[model samples]
Target: MAQSSSKRIFLCNSCGNEYFKWHGQCPACSEWDTLSEFHPPKSRRKSNGAPARKTTKLHTITHKKDRKRTSSGINEVDRVLGGGLLPGSMILLGGQPGIGKSTIAIQIVAGCGKSALYVSAEESEDQLALRAERLGINTKNLHVSGENEIMNVLEQVSVVQPSLLVIDSIQTVYNEDLDSLPGSVSQIRDCGQQLLNACKQKGFTVIVIGHVTKIGTIAGPKMLEHMVDTVLYLEGDERYDHRILRSVKNRFGATNEVGVFHMTSAGLEEVTNPSELFLAERTANTAGTAILPTMEGTRPILVEVQALVSKANFGTPQRNTNGVDSRRLSMLLAVLEKRLGNFMGMNDVFVNLVGGLKIQDPAADLSIISAVASSSKDNVIADGTVLVGEVGLTGEVRSVARIDQRLQEAAALGFKIAIIPKGNMKNVKSFKGLKIHGVKSVREAFQIIF
Candidate 1:
């Protein structure tokens, strides 16, 4: 077959590996059958800008913080957006289907109640209108354009000159310039690049709503994330209505600064203090329940950790955890069993982060082990104690990062007792009002808490 050739590249979405041809397996991330071919549009032969933008020195780059930003009028969005949308900035918001990525984008664009353009290759205007009705957002300022073709979408963007622009999804926008179907690797890369370029040149705030794969990666070329200024992931268990907008990448502010939103009759409602929502109302004190303080961006949050210990029925012990890594939990359990000799080897240990938000940080390790030990021993931890430390495989309690920040955050939130590492304890010496306990090993940790 004669290839009507276009210079293109195949990128592994799992690892950001770029290749000349598609492969059955990724050479980098070792993900099976995840190669997606992408054909990017060559810059228009004649219309390309001359004297390409020069890379300026770091100090030479002008700082213009005082520049005005058009607020989306949604406090949660504004906070997640680092005060508000920077003119011509491209923001990517990825989430599960029907998890309200579109809803939040639509809500944000509805600001100023001015005519903002909403382009959706996925949903028709009628469908979007129905959603708007359900959300009760008056779409008066929202100019709706339903299209699949990238050229047509660009045309609408050029003609409307909307103050705010929202693409319901980046995956569905297909480009005729790319020799592939929409949502394919090539098409997504080309469409995303073009949209980002247009956003920068046009000075219109653009939010590209995206869909994520089951493994929690944005369902497109990894280049899509790099090409944008901000990348936000909307997280929540599909069975639950609450959604978390977490900044995975941010050029304007801190990544990991998250805003909590609950999907409801009105729309995505912001939860100012997510701690209350994460902690269930427990009338009575229970063993194996721990509250830990974590710093998300600049905000401090208190989350509950629960664990249960039962006699293991099988030859090998079974370890399970929710909203945390099972392998890490297993290692922590092993530390407790081997070094501390807490008789947890045959226990069917189960650990859970009260809310469904997955915490991959190593700091949660000590709490996981503590929760399980507390359960096994049937001892309840103090109400004010907040456990924060990394438990090593050898049963040593490693110092956690940003102890001062954690302590300050914990102190701000009314936590009085903190179980931290010995190294951090020596550095701080004294934690003024809060009773900070330093533990070197898992045994010490247990003794200090229980």
Candidate 2:
């Protein structure tokens, strides 16, 4: 067969738009300096007498009854994957460098009790072996390869006939036919497409490790994410010891589900009870600190919301936050000032969610306001008390979802009292040794807390 000719083109990394010539800014997305050189694969000519493709009816397609999921031998991982790993599905695991992306991949494939092939384009085989030793993973069923060429990697996959294949990074691998260098826009897209096709044809699960951009998205064409069956992001703060494996997209499972793990010398360890792990070091009766039961997927986690209110020395008061949105904090402050006559205008306010866990649950609104109020008044909320409600602009406490689950988690953790929205009182069930108080407004909540 004769080699097909290829043409050089420019592609926008942001929008995946092709251009015949380079431009300073992409005309499609208007992003500057995102255009990179690309060598697209030449299209093959079709014969004029080619046969028409046959389509299968959806109802006529047979479904497998005995097809069961294979567990990765880790409960937390299985939870995020919606039970276990599905055959022939491609998973994209992306995170910052040294955030345990590779370590977790090795552990998963090693524990799956199946023949696996791990191809590391970025690291040599010896380096991977040393890291595996550090992780204490020993398995004869796992095969290691240091090939960077996509064709050779696929060839090895064919020879090994493994049930699982891991590409240490999609960025480092390149196709020999493409003129673009590794990690370039064209190389990543072309290499990824080939890998996807191989995975589907060979009936093996593939986990592709990808590097994240400075803004924290997977550093590749947006199409890379769309091409995969699942997209997961490993996220954590550098100062914290815990890492969160969150699923942003899943075809076989639920999205936005999270699995918590603690970083250790032995690699990532599953955090069974994240609520207790997050609240292990709480100081009782501390002002500017409140507990909120927020749900991560179907699991409810109790995290501390801390606020600090101090006099502003400068002209403009600084509003700083960690693990909380600054705009939402400002809105809560405005509500406190307007409704309850509390003056936070001249105070430098800071709010933080403990354990480096970031939550967007509106149920945290009441807890944040309570913590701010407690700090401003120098009053401590009673110990063993939890808050779960959303604060509206009109100062009314709004109901949140899954109030029963949140309260049950609080009760299980020995919380004596729960301050919830009055609207949720109709659905509240009595828990032994736990008292529930329903408040209609922020003022009423303040009265109960202080």
Candidate 3:
């Protein structure tokens, strides 16, 4: 029989609550019965076979074979990953369900499709094969598994010894060494660590798929994110099939790069020209719609904004928006009604990003203001016109950051008119092809565009 020590029940590390015994839950926190009995550590496992590594000079560190990048068979993905996949690098790709996470991975492994081993903890072999068939990815070197056991993966690693290793999901993976069930913090951390160790020891590239929590952060403990070499987040409205993959952390490349993908019947298609997708749906000569050019990471793309105004029956009007912050919408409304005398307080206002894309850039200010004004006056702007600038609360148009990049994007998309900040004209290297009209205030911008 096990002896009890001083009736020493441990409190949850997350929430301070007393437990009579070690349990999976705390009566106070109500946190998935997460209360676990705390016991003194039996021992820490230490490795003894490897020689200690000495710190090398910076120039010498660049000569290693493992530092070289290998292509993932996808150009756009490679660009987002900073040239290509680095050997011994473990990347975590996360997204919501049905967001095509698996499709992207399958495409990535296609380059070495005939020379890699893929251990999928989430789906069985038959299901993976069916997906590959449907997607027309008949690669020779690819292997799939439904097993979640970590020991099985270790054995697979020994036999396959492929150039790349791919895991469908980190959540479904488990290790028999730990008594806790799979998908727990300890299990995920252990599994991720083991896989990373295997990759480094064998000199291979690895990719893991993770599911995002409700808060839009990756699931599992925060430490799991830190353990990976790079972290990529896939976000977009599920309603529209357009997805954006942004690099949040990269040990070897620029962190502010992004890759755009459009969901189609064939598979996830790489978006070569992102500008067309955002502005192609715009109606020519529409008053309540305006085009804005913004950059995600380093990729510049054009987007459109739309607004609608209707009379309010109740004393106060309702303000609603999609793809923009609700609190920011309220502040903008207050500014328009107070500074411009727009009489919008008694009207219902609706704002949308149009393509199911979420943009939180102040550079969209000019387009947003024009959209609101158009809705109020029921007047449409011009065809092939794009607006980019920040609008102050006093109805002044302020200069935005990276105006040149935005202009080049709009010009690339074949937009004819650009209503931009007056201050940007001086800094532009050359405006040879663009018709830019600079404005200092909201009134000036409206007058120039209309």
Top candidate (lDDT):
2
Residue 286, candidate 2: alpha-carbon lDDT: 88
TM-score of each: 0.88, 0.93, 0.86
Q: Who is ahead in lDDT, 1 or 3?
A: 1
What digit string (tens of lDDT, one per residue) describes model 1 on residues 1-450? 124334767778766787777789888878888886666565453122323555668754467565577777778777877888888889999988777888788888765465689898788889998988887787776789888777788788777888778887888888776667888877777778778777776678788888888877888777789889999998888767789999989999887888999888888998987877776563236898887777777666778889999998999877888888888877777687788878876778888887787777788888888888889989988887889888887888898777787787667666788999887876775556788888888788888787
Estimate candidate 1's alpha-carbon lDDT, on a 0 to 1 scale.
0.80
Model 3 spans with C-alpha error above 4 angstroms: 1-54, 63-66, 112-114
TM-score of the candidate numbered 2? 0.93
> Candidate 2: lDDT over CA atoms?
0.90
Q: Is candidate 2 or candidate 3 better by TM-score?
A: 2
Off by over 4 Å in 2: 1-6, 19-33, 42-55, 60-62
Model 3, TM vs. native: 0.86
Candidate lDDT values, in order: 0.80, 0.90, 0.78
